[model samples]
Target: MSEIIRFYSVTDDYGEFSNFAEYPVTLKKVRWPTSEHYFQSQKFKDKKDQQEIRKANSPMLAARMGRDRKRKLRRDWESAKVNVMREAVFAKFTQHEELRELLLSTGDAKIVEHTENDDYWGDGGDGRGKNMLGRVLMDVRQALRDDA
Candidate 1:
């Protein structure tokens, strides 16, 4: 098995792998401060709500806004969330050469978003979560490798 690389906060080792890391991505002619912002903004059906998340000063704020139940979520959001995250991750790595290089440098290592905050996107602090974000990163890494 390849080495395991776990990343959570932006201050930790492999921090660049964190969605909150300072990286900009442009998708659909709009720029987002980070992949987190892009992914979160996409949960809503309303363009105005999406715009609000896109304009948030920080990824954390964008996440908060995205989770606000008062705002209407897209009907297909639950089904489309993984693809949405994939799109954001792909855009982030492709748009930044350094970030692309960083991801590629991981080689075949198992990338994991090690956090207890969300079981779906993280490791659940006990390795029981889905780690979907990590899977997306690895998928993007493979795609980049194939393109090389």
Candidate 2:
């Protein structure tokens, strides 16, 4: 098997794979700062709340805003988050040729979001977590490859 490709910070070797990387994505006719912005904004049903996250100066701030319990999270967020993230990630790669190429360059290597921050989106620093983000990325990679 090819070696696993692990990424976490925007400064990592495969940083472009990170949602926090400086890659803008447009979804639903609205331009967002990054995939992180798009994904975080989607957690809330309120347009105002979503816009606030979209306008956040950094992905980290956007993440924090998305985690704000004071804001009203969408009722379907729990069930819809994976798809939401998939959409944002797909848009990110499709919109940017360089990023798409970067993703494609990985070939069939396993992509991993290596971090302990969130078990659902990352490997939880020990490979026990779900790594949904990595799964979505690989899925998009396959879709892109199929289109090529």
Candidate 3:
């Protein structure tokens, strides 16, 4: 059995992100990419919106977009949103100093999605698999130490 360690998590209708702390800190500015980032990175999930995204990405034309990108985003918000959320949460931890510090203080802390079977990210590693988020956090911790 893996060593029993303290892990933090939040739960609701969506799911959970474990191995985090219950720190009373909020981000000053959320410098994280959103589902909008997925829309921007990939394209519209709706078949009808594909043409618009294609046109927008065309070399001859630029996608004139407002803050929210209007209807040029993925319509299926309930499907396969974990990847987007992962990026966002990771960004949140990395961009904010308070959160980063809080996270680093928790040595070997991890982030696991309660509802998903993500071996690459969730609790697949009982000291034997990849914990991508934890690895990143530790990397940041190392960087911070180096900076100090």
Best of the candidates, lDDT = 2
**Whole-model lDDT, candidate 2?**
0.96
**Which 10-residue window of candidate 3 scores lowest in summed lDDT?**
23-32
Error of 3 at 126 (Å): 5.4
* Residue 110 alpha-carbon offset, candidate 3, angstroms: 7.1
| Model 1 weakest 10-residue run by lDDT | 1-10
Q: Write the per-residue lDDT of candidate 2 for residues 51-124, one digit (tens) a residue.
A: 99999999999999999999999999999999999999999999999999999999899999999887999999
> Can you write out model 3's per-residue Cα lDDT over 28-96, one digit (the tens) per residue?
232112222322333355544543433343211322331236656556653544455455455555555
- Residue 136 lDDT (model 3): 46
Q: Which stretches of candidate 2 lie over 4 Å from their true place?
A: none
Query: Model-by-model lDDT, in order?
Result: 0.92, 0.96, 0.41
Q: Give residue 47's lDDT in candidate 1 (0 to 100).
A: 92
State in Å the error of residue 120, model 2: 0.7
Kindly indicate the candidate among 1 and 2 with the higher lDDT.
2
TM-score of each: 0.97, 0.98, 0.39
Candidate 3: which pairs clash? Answer: none
For model 3, how big is the CA root-mean-square deviation? 11.3
Q: Write the per-residue lDDT of candidate 1 for residues 1-148, one digit (tens) a residue.
A: 4699999999998898888999999999998899989899999878999999999999999999999999998999989999999999999899999999999999999999998887999989899999999999999999999999
